[model samples]
Target: MGEVTINNIQKDESGILKENKKINALEDSVENVEVDGEKYDLTIDGYINMQESEEYTLFLRKSTSGDNYVLTNALLSKYPVEEEEQDELFLEDGESLEETEDLKDTYQELYQEVLKE
Candidate 1:
């Protein structure tokens, strides 16, 4: 545990700033973790869901926040996704190699589009 900083803050309402009893509290909730004689701050950046399973997921942050490099329980991580895998059409068993290649290309294009956004 670390120290907490309390600062006076003003509230904003409809473009107007008013001084109120609000306090901006900054708490150092981060824990210090040690590995191989070295200590590190275990800060939570964020989390990510498993690509294909809703019950499984991963944290996308640094090597801290408990089990850093492992797939954590979705519920424990507090960032579970309702759906893990994106809906994708499967190629038929008898599909030609060219068709499969075309499908791959299409998937790549859609993935790129999503990344752009």
Candidate 2:
């Protein structure tokens, strides 16, 4: 007589045997976020706290996707830093303003009106 081995498994919708396991939300923690094998840096821009439900949510923004935002759990530690400001450059000494013929005529009329005042 052959011995029988029993496995605590069930077939899924696809007919594949899958082991049953318990999933606990408190034990789950996000270690790192990545897309296409590249790590994505998300910045915490805002937050929402629901005292009634005792839930806290964090809003994050990514520079790669301008103006787009993402929401994640408050426990996430990967936050973005403020970007540095760039200096502005004005016209040089040799640079001059370009005006069209219509603009020149309008400016002359305005100048005459101002002089009369």
Error of 2 at 55 (Å): 64
Candidate 1, 55: how far from true, in Å? 13
What TM-score should be assigned to candidate 1? 0.21
Model 2 TM: 0.17
| lDDT (Cα atoms) of all candidates against the true structure | 0.32, 0.28
- Tens digit of per-residue lDDT, candidate 1, span 1-117: 211121222222333222342222222223346789887644332212222223211222222544223223311322222322323322133434674466545644554554343
Native-structure RMSD, model 2: 25.6
lDDT of 2 by residue, 1-117 (tens): 111121232223434322443211221122236979986433222211212222222223222444332333332311112221111111122323353334334533543443353
Which residue pairs of candidate 2 clash? none
